[model samples]
Target chain A: MKVRSHRAGKLLKGLWLALVLAFLYIPIIVMIALSFNASVSRAAWTGFTLDWYVKLFKSKQIMAALNVTITVAVIATVVSTVLGTLGAIGMHAMSTGMANLLINVSYLPMTTPDIVTGVSLMLMFIFVKVPLGKWTMIMAHIAFDTPYVLFSVMPKLRQMNPNLYEAALDLGCHPAKALYKVIIPEIMPGIVTGALLAFTMSLDDFVISYFTSNTDQNLAMIVYSAARRGVEPTMYALSTLMFIVVLGLLLIVNRRNGLEDIA
Target chain B: MKRSWYAAPYGVWMVLFTVVPLLFVLYYAFTDQSGAFTVNNFVKIASPMYGLVLWDSLRLAFFCTLLCLLIGYPTAYFLASRDFSNAQTLVVLILVPMWMNFLLRTYAMMTLFENNGVINTLLESLGLERIQMIGTEGAVLVGMVYNFLPFMVLPVYTVLKKMDYSVIEAAEDLGASPIRVVSRVVLPMSIPGVVSGITMVFMPAVTTFAISRMLSSGMIYLVGDMIEDYFIAMNNRNVGSTISLVMLVLIILSIGLLRKVDPDNTGGGLW
Candidate 1:
C-alpha cells in the first residue's frame, strides 16, 4: 500500500507539471502552428499555406511601418544606451539620498502603466511645442527606456572596483580616458545587456508609440491600425513575424544571462 | 572634474524630457485651462461613470491579483527548488509572450475565446455545445492572468530561491509534516515575494484598458476604459488628469499600507 501511494504521488506530480506547462504554452503553440495554416485568416485554420509569406513582402505599408519601427528603435536604443550608461556612471559618484530619489524617479516610467505614460508624455510634448513626429517618439521612448538601461547597469556600476579607476588615474590617464579604458571594460556585460534591453523596449513598445506616432512612425501603430480595420488578414502574418523575433530575442537573452541565473 | 560639452547635452535631455514632463504633470494637476483656476475637473471625476469604472477596475484587478497568487505560489516554489538543466527555457517561455505587444495578445485572446473560436469549436467537437467563454468576466480574467503571470512569477521566484532550506529541515526534524512545514515556515518567509508579486500584477491589471476593451464587448467599462474615454473620446484632459491624480493618491496610500508589513521598510514587498 505504501509503495502504491508513493507511485501515485509521483504520477500526480508529473500530471501537475504537464498541466501547468501546457496551460502556459497552448496559445503560443496554437498561434505558431496556424501561422503555417495556408489560410491567412486567423479567424480559423482552413488549410496550410505559405502564400502569406509571399504577400508579407508585397505590402508597402508593412514595409514602411517596418522601416519606421527599425529606425525609431535603433535611434532610441543608441540614445538610451549612452545616457543610461552615463547616468549609471554619474550615479556612482554620488552616495546620497538624492541618488536614491533620482533612481526611484528614473524607474517611475517603468512602473507606471503605459496608457498613463503615453497620454501624459504626449500632452507634455505637445504643450512644450515639441513637434510630434519621429523625434517626439524617440524622446518619449528615451524617457521610459532609460530606466531599464539604468536599472540594468546601476548595480553592476556600483559593484566595480574603484581602485581600477584610481590606478588608471595614477598612470596619468585623463578621467575620460580612464573611464573609457577601465570603466568600460569592467561594465561591458552590463552595457551590452542594457542596450539589448533598450532595443527590446523600443521595438515592442505600443502605448507611447500609439499616442505619439504620426502617419509614418512605428510598426506597433501600424499593427494597431490594421487590427482596427477588422483584423487585417496580414496582421496574423505580422504577429507570426513578431513571434519569431521575440522568440529569437528570448533565446539570445537566456543564453547570455545563463539558465542558472534566470532560475 | 571637468564637465565636457557632453554634460550640456545630458543636461538638455534631462530638462527637455524627464524633468520638464514631470513638472508638466504636477503643473497640469493644479491648473484650470478650462479657463480659470477652478476645481471642476476634480468634480467631473466624481461622476457616476468614473466611480463605477473605478470600482470595476478595482474589482477586476483584485480578482486578477488573487488568481496570480493562487497560480503563482506553488509554481514558484516548485521552480525555485528544482535543479533543471534548462530553467532558462522555462523562464523564457513565461517571458517571451510579454515581448509581443499587449494589443496583439488581447486581439489574439479574442480569436481564441470568441463564440466562433477554438475554445467553443473544441467544446462543440467534444459534445458540449452550449458553453459561453467570451464577452464575459471570465474572458477578462483569462486575459489578466495570461498577461500578468510573468510579473507574479519573476518576483516570487526571486524571493523563493533565496529562502534557506535549513529552516525547513529544522521544521522537519521537529516532526512536522511537509504540509505543516510549508504553511508555517516557507509561506511566511516568502511574504516579500508575495507582496511584490501582488503589487506588480495589481498595478497594471487595474489600469489596463486594452484587455477589457478587446474582450468585454462593451458590456464592461473598467476604470482604465473610463480614463481612456475621458481623454480620447471626450477630449477632457482636465478630467483625465484629475482621475490620474486621484488614482495616484490611492496607489500611494496602498503602498503606505503595504509598507507596514515590512518592519525595517528596507524595500517593497517585491524587491
Candidate 2:
C-alpha cells in the first residue's frame, strides 16, 4: 500500500508540474500565434497571413527604433563587460571586507526602482546636465550593468587557480602578460554570460530609456508609445523577431557550452 | 607612467558619471528652491493626494506580491521538486519570457484584455457579457503578475532547491502525512526565499508606471504615475523629489524589517 501510494504521489507531482509549465507558456504562445494569424481578430482565425511581418519592414519609425535599441544594447554591454570584469578582478585581489563592501555598493543601483534610477540619472544630467541622449542611456546602463557583470564573473574568478598567474609571474612574465594570458582566460565564461545578461537587460529597458533617452526611441519605448492608441501589427512583428533572437542566442550559448541551462 | 591611465577607467567613469549624479539627486531630494535644505519637501508627503498615492502603492504591491506568490510558489515547487533530466529545459523555457521586452509583453497582454481582444471575445462566445477585466484595478494586478511572476518564481525556486530533501524523508519516516510534512517543514524552510520574492515582486509593483499606464489607461492612477506626472508633466520637481525620498525611506524600512525577520537572509548568497 505504501509503495503504491508513493508511486501515485509521484505521478501526481509530475502532472502538476506539467500543468504549471503549460500555464507559464500558454500566454506567450498565444502572442506568438496571434502574430502569425492571417485574421486580424484573435476572436476567430480567419486564415494564414505573413502581411504583419511584411508590414513591419515597411515602417521607417520602427526601423529607426530597432536600430537605436540595438546600438544602445551593444555599446552598453561591451562597456559594462570590460568594467565589470576588471572590477571583479580588482575585488578578487583586494582583502575580504573591502571586496564585500565594493561588491555591495556596486549592486545597490540594481536594487533601486527604475524610476529612481531614471529620475536620479536625469536629474544628474540636468544638474551638471549634459544633454540626455544615447550617451546618457549608455551611462545609466553602465552604472547598473557593472555590478551585474562583476557578480557574474566573481565566482568564476574565485574558482580559478591562482598559481597559474603566480607561475607566469615566476617565469618572468610581465604583470599584463600574466593577467591577459592567465586570469582573463579562466574568467571568459563568466564574462560572456554577464555580457549576454547585460545585453538583454539594456534591450528590455523602458523607464530609464523613457526618461534619459533624447528624441530617440528604443524597441520598448516605441511599443509603449504605439500601444497608447492600439498595438500596431509591426509591434507584434518586431517583438516576435526579438523573441526569436533572444531564444536563438540562448540556444547557441547553451549548445556551445553543452549545458541545458545555466546553473 | 600613470596609475590612473589604464588601471581603473571604470572607476573613473563611475566617479564622473554614476557617483556624481547620484549625489546630485540626493542633494535635490533634500533642498528647497532657495537652496535652503528643509524637510518641507518631505513634509509634502502628508498631503491627502500623496497620501492616497502611498496607499495605492502599498495596495498594489501587497496584492501583486500575493498573486505572484500564489502562482509562482506552486510552479517553483514543482520545478524544484522534479528529478527528471528534462525539467531544467522547462525551467529555462519558463524563464525565457524574463528577457522579452517589457513594453511588448504589456502590448501582448493588452491584445488579450482589450475590448475586442481575445479574453472578452471568448467570454462572449461562452454567453458571458461585459466581464470588465480590462481598464479596472484587476487588469493592473494581472499585468503585474504576468510580468513579475518569473521574478518571484526564480527566487523561490532557489530556496526550494536548497532545502534538504532528507528533511521531508525524515518527516515522512516519522509518520507525518504528506500535507503535514509540507506545511510543517517545507513551508518553514522556504521563508527566506519567500521574503526575497515578496520584496522583489512588491518593489516593482509599487514603482511600476508602465503596466498601470498601459492596462489601466491612465484612469487608474498609481503612485508611480503620480510621481511621473509631477516631475515630468507638471514640472513639480520640488514635490516629486520629496515623494521619491519618502518612497526610498519606505522601501529601505520595509527591506530592513523583512531581512530582520528572515533569519537566514544574512547569508551573502545570491539566487
Candidate 3:
C-alpha cells in the first residue's frame, strides 16, 4: 500500500507539471497556428497559407518599427554596458559604506514600477523642454538597463582576485593598462551577460518606451496599437518570427552560461 | 582612490536621470496645472471613483499573486525535484516564453479569449453558446497569471534547487510521512523563495498597464491603466504623478518586507 501510494504521488506530480505546461503553452501555440490560417478571422481556418509571413515582411509600418526597435535596443545596450561596467569597477574600489550607498541608490530604477519610471521620465523631459522621441526612449532604457549591467558585473568583480590588478601594476603596467589587460578580461563574462540582458530588456520594453516616445514607435508600441485596434494575421506572423529569434538567443545563452546567473 | 573617481560620469548621469526625474514626480504630485504647490491632486485620488480603481487593483493583484503561488509552488517543486530527469530543460522551457516580448505574449492571450476567438469557436462547433471572455475581470486575472507565472516559478525553483535533499531523506528514514516531510521540512526551507516569488509576481502584476489593456479589451482599469490614461489620454500629469507616488510607496514597502524575510539576498535579487 505504501509503495503504491508513492507511485500515485509521483504520477500526480507529473500530471500537475503537464497541466501547468499545457496552460502556459496552449495560448501561444494557438496563436502561432492562427498565423498560418488563410482567413484573418481567428475562428475559421479555411486553409493554411504563408501569406501572413509574406505580408509581415512587406508591411512598411512593421518594418519601420523593427528598424527603430533594433536601433534603440543596440544603442541602449552599448551605452549602458560601458557606463555600468565603469560604474561597477568604480564602486568596487570604493569604501564599503560608499559602495553600499551607491548600490542602494542604483536599486531605485530597478525597484520602481516601469510605469512610474516611464511617467517620471516623461515629466522630466517636459520639465527640461526636451521633446519625447527616440533619444528620450533610449535614455530611459539606459537608466533601467544600467543597473542590471552594474549588478551582473559586480558579482564578477567580487569573485576576482584582488592581487591580479596589483601584480599587473607592480610589473610596471600603467593603471589604465592594468585595468584593460587584467581587470576587463577577468570580468568579460559578466560584461557580455550584462550587455545581452540590456539588449533583451530594451527590446522587450513597452511601457517605458510607450511613454518616452512620441513620433518614434518601436515594435512593441506598434504591436500595442495594432493589438488594441484588433487582431491582425500579419501581426501574429511578426510575433512568431520575433519569438523564434528570442527563443534562439535564449537557448544560446542558456547553453553558454546556464541562464541561472541572469534570472 | 583614483579608481573610485571613475564612477564620476555615471554618478552625474544617475543624478540627472534617476534622481532628478523622481523629484519631478514628487513635484508634479503636489502641484496643480499652474505649477504651484497644492494638495488637490491627493484630494482627487481620495474620491470614490479613483479609490475604487485602487481597491480593484489591489484585489486583482492579490488574487493574481495567490493563483501564481498556488500554481507555481508545485511546478517549482517538480522542476527542482531530483526525481525529474530533465529539470534543466524544463527550466529553460519556462524561461523561453518569458523572454518573448511582453506585449506580444499578452496580445497572444487575446486570440484565445476573444468572443470569436479559438475557445469560443470550439465551443460553438460543439453546439454551445459563446461565453464572454474578453472585457471581464476574469480575463484580466488570467492574463496576469499567464504572464507572471514564470516570475513566481523561477525564484522558488532557484531556492528549491539549492536546497539540501538529505534533510528530506533523513525525515523519510525517521518514519515521517511524505505529507509531514513536505509540510514541516520542505515548506519551511522554501519560505525565502516563496517570499521572493511573491514579490516578483505581485509587483509587476499590480502595476501592469499592458496586460489589463490587451486582455480586458479596455473594460478593466488597474492602477497602471489609470496612470497611463491620466498622463496620456486625459493630459493630467498631476493626478498621474500622485497615483505613481502611491505605487512607489507600495513597492518600497514590499521590498522592505522581502529584505526582512531574506536578508542575505538569495532568490536572485528581485529584478
* Best model per DockQ: 3
Candidate 3 accuracy as lDDT: 0.88
Interface RMSD of 2: 2.8
Point out the higher-scoring one by DockQ: 1 or 3. 3
lDDT of 1 by residue, A204-254 (tens): 888778766555657777766665454444666678787678657656765
Cα lDDT tens digits for candidate 3, A1-263? 97898788788988998898888898888889989999989989799999999998898998899998999999999999999999999999999998888888798887778888899999999999999999999999999889888988998999999999999989999999999999999999989888887888888888899999998999889889999898898889888888887776666655657767547
B102-164: candidate 2 lDDT, tens digit per residue:
677777888888888888888999998947666898888888888888788777787888788
Ranking by DockQ: 3, 2, 1
Winner on TM-score (2 vs 3): 3
Backbone clash tally for model 1?
4
The list of candidate 2 runs beyond 4 A from truth reads A1-15, A253-263, B1-7, B15-17, B33-38, B82-85, B266-271
Query: What is candidate 3's lDDT per residue for B162-225, written digit by digit as tens?
Result: 8999999999999998789999999989988998889888889889888898888778988999
Q: Is candidate 1 or candidate 3 better by TM-score?
A: 3
lDDT for B73 (candidate 2): 85
Instruction: Estimate TM-scores for all models.
Output: 0.91, 0.92, 0.97
Specify the highest-lDDT model's number: 3
Regions of candidate 3 where Cα sits further than 4 Å from its true position: B258-265, B268-271
Which is the better candidate, 2 or 3, if ranked by DockQ?
3
